[model samples]
Every structure is written in C-alpha cells, then in structure tokens.
Target: MKKNKNLLEVPNINSSDAQLKKIIYKVEDNIFNRFFNSFSKSEYLCVCSGGTTSSCARDNFITLDLRKEYDHIHLEKEKNLIKIGGGVIMKDLMNFLGSQNKIFPTGLSKLPGAGYLLTGGISPLSRRYGLAIDNIETIKGYLGNGTFISLEKNNLSSDQKLLWEGFKGAAPFLAIITEIGLKTFQAHPIQIIEGFINDNELSKIINLAEGFPENLSLQWIYAQDIYIYILAEIRNDLDKEITKKYLNKLENFSSLKIKTYENYNQINFFPKELDLFELNKNNHSEVISLLGEDLKERIQIFIKCMKEIIRSKPNNSCYVASQQLGGKTKEIDPKSSFFIHRKSTWKPWIYASWKKDDLKEKEIVLNWMNESWEKLKIFFPKIHLAQIHNHLNSHEEEVYLSFEERLSELKTLKNICDPESILPPL
Candidate 1:
C-alpha cells in the first residue's frame, strides 16, 4: 500500500529503518504502548503529513507511501512559535516559516494539507487570523485509546470529550495530530499585489472590494486568467510606500494587467520546483461558507445557486470568495469550537477537477454541490450559523447550530461517533 509519485513527501522514520509502515515511530518512551496497540486493529493507521494531508484515525485509512520513509529531521522555530512534525510539508512549512521571520495562516499553494489547511476550515490569513482551527495553540499526538494527550485551545472541549470518535467530516478520526503548535505571523515586510482581468469590470471590482478597509487582503480568482490578489499589512516603515497607492487603485479599476511585487516575505511560498503533487486530478472542489446576512440576499443566493451550478457542468467554473469576517474574524465566540464562522460571509468554491472514472460523473459534481445547498434553503430565512463540514453537499455536520439545530446535532454525532461508518470514499 505504499505508492507515491509525490503526494508531496515529508518523511521521517529512522532508528536505522526498523521497518517503518504508515509512520508514527515516536522514539520509544515505552514504545508508545506498542504503537498504540498496533493502531487499533489497523484498518488504516496513517500519520502521513506532507500537503495531501493524513493521519487517518480511520477513514478506512490508507495512505502508506512513506517516501521510503525519508529521515530528514531538523527542528527549531520561533518568533511567535512553531514546532512541527505532523509529517511537515507545505514546502517544508515554508522553509520553516521563512526561517522564523514568521507567517502562518497558510495556503495559496505551498501545496495543501498544512493539516489540510488547518483542519479543513481555510487560511491564507483567513481574512486575517480566523480559522486554521483558531490558530491552533497546541496538538501533540497518538490517540485511538492508546493515549498520549496534549490538545490545547483551552482543552478542545475536554479533548472532544477524551478523543473524538467520528463524523460530520470526522476529523480524519481524531488523533495522530502530532506536533502542530502554530500561531505565528509578522512577515508582511511589504509589497504583494497581483492582478489580471478578462473583462466585465467584475462588478466594479466587487464594489471596490466591498469597500476596502482593515489593512487590505483581497482575492478573486476565476482561474486561467481573472485573478487579483492585493494584500498589504506593512505595520509601518513609512507605510511601505502605501503599496504603490494600492497598485494605483488596481490600475484604475481593472482591465487585465500587472503582477508580482515580492515580499510576502520574498515569495517562493512553496510548490517546490514543480511536480505539483502528481496531479491525478480526480476532480474535487465544493466549498461554501457564507453564513449569510443579506448582501442583497447574498446576491440572490448567488443567482439561485447559479442555476444549480450551471446545470452541474458542461465544462463549469466557479469561485466566489469575498473574505473579511471583520478584524480577527468575528473575534471568536460563535461557540468557539476553534472556528464555527461567527459570521463567515463569502467563500463559494464549486470546482470541476477533471479525471473521471465516471462514478456517475462524480455524482454530477456531488449532485451539483447538493443542489447548491438546496438553493441555499431559499436564502434560509437569512441564515446565521452552522459549522464543521461547512456544506459540501451536507449530511449537515454541525459544530454549533441554527439550521434547525445543525440538522439534529448532526444526526446524533453520526450515531455515536461513526457507528461502523469507517469514513472515506466521500
């Protein structure tokens, strides 16, 4: 079960190769109780960390290509903090957070799985420090009843009541979260603007980025051309030349142009010399996170969920992105299971990642993103809450609710932590 062209490798297993499988060799300490009871019957005992992300406590776990178990270890980081090795790999945690000049809300291609971008919420300074599971304050590893605690973020609700068992997007089945104490930042060092447009002043550049403010950090990519990234957070040094007057106000309101400015701490943010994680693009992309609050009824619930995602494709393309939940992301308190969108407005995704094995055309792109969340429940009386599996064709996984009690406590926490559901094959 060890195959890899490059799911983005970041190995570590030595002691002179004492047969490393699905890695988690914690240098003795009572042999971590025989590797946690041989990983509770091993249906999938992964710790695979290197972008594509893994540590499947049981998603029927299968990801064993430990790059012949590479033994490249060298740890040490500071400037706010970092302590990696949950199989580390977003371009080696951006060359160790740009050698501690620091930065961490990760994503924007350094290859995914910075713990699948902080336990699958979102990042890239998620509208400036919000999700990345609340900038995790600690993690440490091994669980499946073989115990080895150390969670943090004020004891993730008593460690999800002594270790999460499963469901609503089962945190890959809780535990093997090894070494993720991140929470760093301070690398702005000035300059980082990008632009390109194909036409249609994209609704007055999304209305001057919804009336820009809060030290700007904007994006709106339609891929293949129609991208715009303007991020500025100089923290004085003479306002770093006011980012060239915001790149001359995005070249006087768009029409295709300019790119690059350097100093997002000098780029090279990861995607190591090519080989993009062996692109076997079996299509995937359907993320929605607009917790609603009438932006003209969220643009009429996005044109009625864009006519069911343009009839679920005949070559489709989508990506909405508004981002900015207000300084420090709604200052927590949405019930705080790390990040349950206290007011998450704008984050539409819906891609069409080609590579069909025709499982009914990938269930018509997940049934057209579950019929755009059932036409966003006819603008669900202007929604307000709901988290975890943030709607990607919902079985409605909750973290805190409002959509009628997160679909009945996410179906009783998936019938008491995955009653035989073995997750995966989503």
Candidate 2:
C-alpha cells in the first residue's frame, strides 16, 4: 500500500516522461482491483482536485492528487463544447473561455472543476442556462472498481443511463471524474450592481428579484451589515433594454446603495488573490437552505434568524449569503439528473470560520451554525450537496435530502459501481 503523503508534487498526466506514464497507467489498472480483493483495509485512496472546497482532500486517506496530473482545458468552438480536466480551477477555466468568447455555468470562479459538477453546480448564470449538470454532454472517469467508464446521455444503456443520472448530482460517490464535456454559450459583457441593504429592506428586493428576467442574477452576502451584489448579462445587443428594465426594479429598495459596472469580468465577483478555501482552512462550517417560491413570504424571518446568529457568533468572520436559483434551473426535466430541488428560488447558506487549534471557538461556531440551521430549515427544507457534502459532516441522510425520492435509486446505482466503497461515504 502507498504511504499517506502529500501528492501535490506529482507531475501532470500529459508529461513527456515515459517512466511516469508507465507508472500512472499501472497504478490506474490495479488500484481498484487491489481494494476489492484485499483483506486489509488499512489504507484507502481518495482523489484530490486542488482541495479547493473539499474537506475530503485534507483527510487521512491516501491522496491521489489530480491537480498536477490532469489540468487540461480544450475548447471546440465549432461544436460549442468544451472538455475540461477535473483538476482545472474555475479561474483558469473562465479566463480560457472568456478569451474564446464563450462561457459555461460555473457557480463561482474559485471553485475546483470535478467537485463543482459532482455536487450539482449552481451557477450565477444558472437562472438562464440552468445548473452546470444540465450543460454536461459527457463525463469520462474511473469507477471505484478500477473500471474505466465513459458516459453520454444518447449512448447509454438502461443501467448505464441510471448511473449517468446519479453521476450528474452525486458523482463523488460513484467515480473519480477525469474530464467533462459541457455545452457552452456565447460570451457577453456583464453589468454589475453592488451595494448594502438593511434586513428590513431584504424582503422587497427578494420580491423584485423573484420576477427578474433570465439575463439577471442576484447574489448577496450578509455580514455584520448586509451587502447586495447583482450581475446582469446581455446575451445579445438587443437584450440591453430588457436588462435595464430589470435593473430598474431594484430602485424600489430606497435603502439599497447601488453602483453599476459595465463589461465586468465575472471573476471579479470574488476577491482577487484570495483563496476562499484557504481562508477557511482551519475551522469552517457552512449550512445550506434551499428556499422555494414561498421565500417571498419568509424572507424577513430568515434574515432575522441570521441576524440573531451573527449577534451571538464568536467572531466577525462568519456571515449569511444567498444565490438566486429559479429561472431556467426549474425548467429541467425531473428525470435528467439527481438534482431534485429545481423549484427553489434561493439557496441561502451560513458560513463560519475560525483559527486552527482553537477547539473552543470551533465548537461555539459549529453550535451556532447548527442552531441557526434548525430554525431556518423550516423555511428552506432542502439542501444543495455541492455546498455541503459528506466531507463536511453531511451524512447519507442529509445528502439524500437533496435528492428526495430519488435517493434509493441513486444508492442502488452506487452499489453497482462502487461495491467495495472505495470513494468517500455519501
């Protein structure tokens, strides 16, 4: 068995070194077989893709780091498809797509590749183009039993089709995705409006946003004070007037201080030179709430609960944030994937971070987060696995809540593909 050590130094899979290529091919062929046939379970392999937002990457399992091995990004403009390596980071992917005048629905610019798709990626553009899973045409990866698998919707058998559906939302449990082929859209300049608003004014903004057009997306981060951010993209020159009409709706919130930026880079939505995963490296916990259209009525109550939690928080680093989710996201066919919370209008999440080795602070923040979740969950019952999975204390029950009735079907598919349970527990 390979000893547990940092796999960061491993070279890319495309390296010219003949010796390394031979070693990687040999490892790939026998790794899964060994796990299935071996009596000793002393060591297990866990795949890593830069460890950007996954707690699994930091665990004690022997790491199979893909960041150095499979970071390729290829664009096929004529076909409107892009094939991205699992190890590619969102920043690099977005920049490459931008240069080619194309775009894919990746929720955040800082997120890693595979985890984003495996967890049912909810993007800023999801309101228009649908979730990232909806854009996937094919996924090439290795099943837990060391068998290589290539999946595409049109070419799958009945059983493979079932596995494909599960792969769309719960892929981390079934396979280690190596590359993904996704549909792309024409790139357009974005108009950004950002500002602050009080909790009382949050309701009015939510009402206005509920009726927003497909071109606009609303996102907000509520810290000690609530800060609002909006991104409106014009797919064509003709859509500018419609975009302006939507922006005008926000004027109703008098307390909202807003500023507009034309032709902004979507990446600028996050802080430059900051690694969000690194910021929460020590002790961090996040609870998600998938709020439906009823959110219009419960918006104030939700904000109030978050305020109370913030007031009692151990530190100022923790906050409440949400992303708009309805538009095209709800229009996807129910049988297409395991992402079942299609009717949800907003995905609100609570994030808390503390210093390393500060067990007291960690306990306090986790308790506060869990308490707040209990109160807020009644308003938004569903959870998005992409934001919270097994690595972050999420169990099979909680993870299955995101899939609802489809959980059993997904589990059967998991049993067939990963009988030895080589992947993380879901």
Q: Model 2, 1-426: lDDT tens per residue?
A: 223223233222111111111122223677777555642353345565645443434333455666666788898878888888877777777788877777888775455657776777877888888998999898998887777988876699876888788888888878888888889888777777666678776767776787788878788777677667677787676668987776677677665454443333354654524222234434444455455454766767767777787787776667777888778988988788888887887887777666645778877877777776777777777877765445445455477668879888877877887877877655
For every model in order, what is the number of clashing pairs? 3, 1
The residue-by-residue lDDT of candidate 1 on 286-336, one tens digit each, is: 343444432442543454455444545533333333333444565665544
- Itemize residue pairs with steric clashes in candidate 2: 13-69
CA lDDT of every candidate: 0.45, 0.69
Q: Give the runs in model 2 whose Cα sits over 4 Å from its true position.
A: 1-27, 35-44, 252-266, 272-291, 387-394
Those runs of model 1 whose alpha carbons end farther than 4 Å from true positions after fitting are 1-42, 46-79, 82-103, 108-114, 117-139, 142-175, 186-219, 223-227, 249-251, 254-350, 353-358, 363-426
TM-scores of the candidates are 0.30, 0.87
Worst 10 residues of 2 by lDDT: 13-22
What is the alpha-carbon lDDT for the whole of candidate 2?
Answer: 0.69
Lowest summed lDDT across 10 adjacent residues in model 1 is found at 10-19
What does the lDDT read for residue 360 in candidate 1? Answer: 67
